[model samples]
Target: MPGSAPLTTKDGRFGYEAAGDPASQPLLFLHGIGGAARAWRGQLDFFRDRYRTIAWDMPGYGGSAPLPDVSIAALAGALQDFLQAVGATNPVIVGHSIGGMIVQQWLAKNPRTAGAVVLAQTSPAFGKPDGDWQKSFIDARLGPLDRGETLVTLAPSLVNELVGDDPDASGMDLARDCMAAVPGATYRATMLALMGFDLRSALKAIAVPTLVLSGSKDNNAPAPMMAKMASYIPSATYVELEGVGHLANLERPLAFNAALDQFLKANVTATQVTA
Candidate 1:
């Protein structure tokens, strides 16, 4: 298995960490608001032997350039450009949290761009932006920064809330490091960008083979929400990983990788045969 290393596009607009064989089928991993490219290290290493695995630090995270504005459409556009730059055609996309939202937005615009999609521990909507719940959600996260605390100071508690009841120490450390490294401005922008996101209606139009993976203990994107999300897409398969939390890939890498491998083999093989 190959290790992840920094990679830049020819245009220098995007930066990512890539592993695996360039000649193999591409598998792209997108991380959540609290994550960076390194969040998918386990997946990249696990799948590198069989696929060209790449994990991107979304625009504004890691060394990637920040977008002028943060919104689902804009993020999706950035993803489109990144795909083109990397020469990936109809690759498999494995997205977590907001990363899953980006994949959904991208699929809404380019239904045929992916060979398959894995929506892991994410929701189809953020609920009403003006609703009390939304306000509370945003306030709770932003209030810390408002009080003059940096991400480094808030990372421990934030990550604690996001992980499972019993999480690996190493996974917790990685999550903390990723969250702590995020710039305050970018984190705030991303939080606000998700305010009015709603793609429930567009799920049925996703024509590619899809897998919805959920963590049984994920409070943020609960199993029920993921099940409903899976139901919206035609013939989508839903798998719940017991004892895992929002960071399913990190919390239970072996199980996560196994589920993904099974899905890719079945769906990618079928798609190739039909083509």
Candidate 2:
């Protein structure tokens, strides 16, 4: 298990965990609303030998500062700053859930910046934030907090519902720990932020090769929706891991890593013969 002390920007606005050499082509990871930078440990450990692995604690998570306005656009702006700060030029970007949405927003605005992209267990849109389904979702997550259940107290049961029937024990523990650390306010703000995201129109404009990773058992971002999303991207490869749910990376690291590794080799590394 490769790991390191989490690092923060000198100004204290951004925080992340980095492993491997900065000289290497970067492998940047973005975790879901329920997760923090450490959720990417399995990936950092697996890919650090060949790529510079870095995982950010999205604004408001970990030591990162909370945004005055938590929107996709704002997150993307922060992402740009983080990239510039860390000197991650045309990095191979991997984003999961809300992280995936942020990546889409970043690519939508800065189309040519990434060497390749990976969107795992995410959707193109949340539909109208006020719509019935969306409201239900927002309520399901926030209702607990509204009733005074903090993220730390709600994390265990929340993670249990997110994982597959049989998940990796250590991975489940890691996922729980990550979820437990999320700030309650951050979760609320991010949930509302998700309501405003709609990136379907920008999918075809994705400039780099893309990997759309889905989990067959994912109810949050269903497999069918992800498949259709892949169809919209110009150069997209779709891979669905069976028996896994929304937390595919933590639910089944081997299958998730294999899909990611293959995508990087064919779409990113092959292009980066320099690395």
Candidate 3:
């Protein structure tokens, strides 16, 4: 999806890659902490002819500017700014991992901002900021960087651990490349950002069609967690991919895209939904 140089927002605070007709319905993809916009090549290509498909690099990744304060709310504001700059309206957003968290936060404020959303491989809460699970999670991600190893060196192992039982060879390679490109500092910031996330209460307030897609093998955001999350959202539909892991979109892109496309057609494009 990325061109020779990434496309920047009017304020130059965000960078994104886009395809398809700009005047068409907006279909934006937000990558996880380990990924940049280029990681969404499959999604961009698949939806390019049908919608204005755009994939964005989170602030501080790729050509996007870094945020002074990194919180779920701040990231949500950045998302709004980026979409506005690109003239995207009534968008159908697909968010993975932390990207999903940002969508939840954005909807918390602007309940009707999106026409529909897919929250894939994500959770509503991370326990507590200073809890053992939170600490261990952050430590695990940042430990290698602290030991003087770069993401380039650790990407192979990290990606290996995140994939499912069935994975595409090319997708695995792209996942590694995206993880390797992530700056260590931004990764650390985002990991810490997860500690403060507790959007369980906000789930019920979302006023748009939502898909809570999960992987049975995703220990990070387990299937049960996603199912419970779906139960909380009034308009949510839950779907779990068997034998899949945390990186469902990358590992099982075909299935992931199928589920997402089906949800969009049923709730958004093929039907008229109020946003």
Q: What global local distance difference test value does model 2 have?
A: 0.89
The per-model lDDT (C-alpha) reads 0.89, 0.89, 0.87
True-vs-predicted CA distance for residue 57, candidate 1, Å = 0.7
User: In model 3, what is the error at residue 168, expressed in angstroms?
Assistant: 0.7
lDDT of 1 at 256: 86
Better of 1 and 3 by lDDT: 1
Expressed as tens digits, the lDDT of each residue in 63-116 for candidate 3 is 899999898888999999888888888899999999999999888888997889
TM for every model, in the order presented, reads 0.96, 0.96, 0.95
Candidate 3 deviant stretches above 4 angstroms: 1-5, 270-275
Instruction: Show pairs that collide, candidate 2.
Output: none
Off by over 4 Å in 1: 270-275
Using TM-score, rank the candidates from best to worst.
Answer: 2, 1, 3
- lDDT (tens digit, per residue) of candidate 2 on 1-275: 65755898778888999898777888999999999998998898899888888999999999899999999889999999999888887799999998999999999888998899999999889999779999999999999999999988888899988877799999999998988888899999998998868989999899799999999889899999999999999999999899999999898999999999988888775223233
Model 3, C-alpha of 64: deviation from truth (Å): 0.3
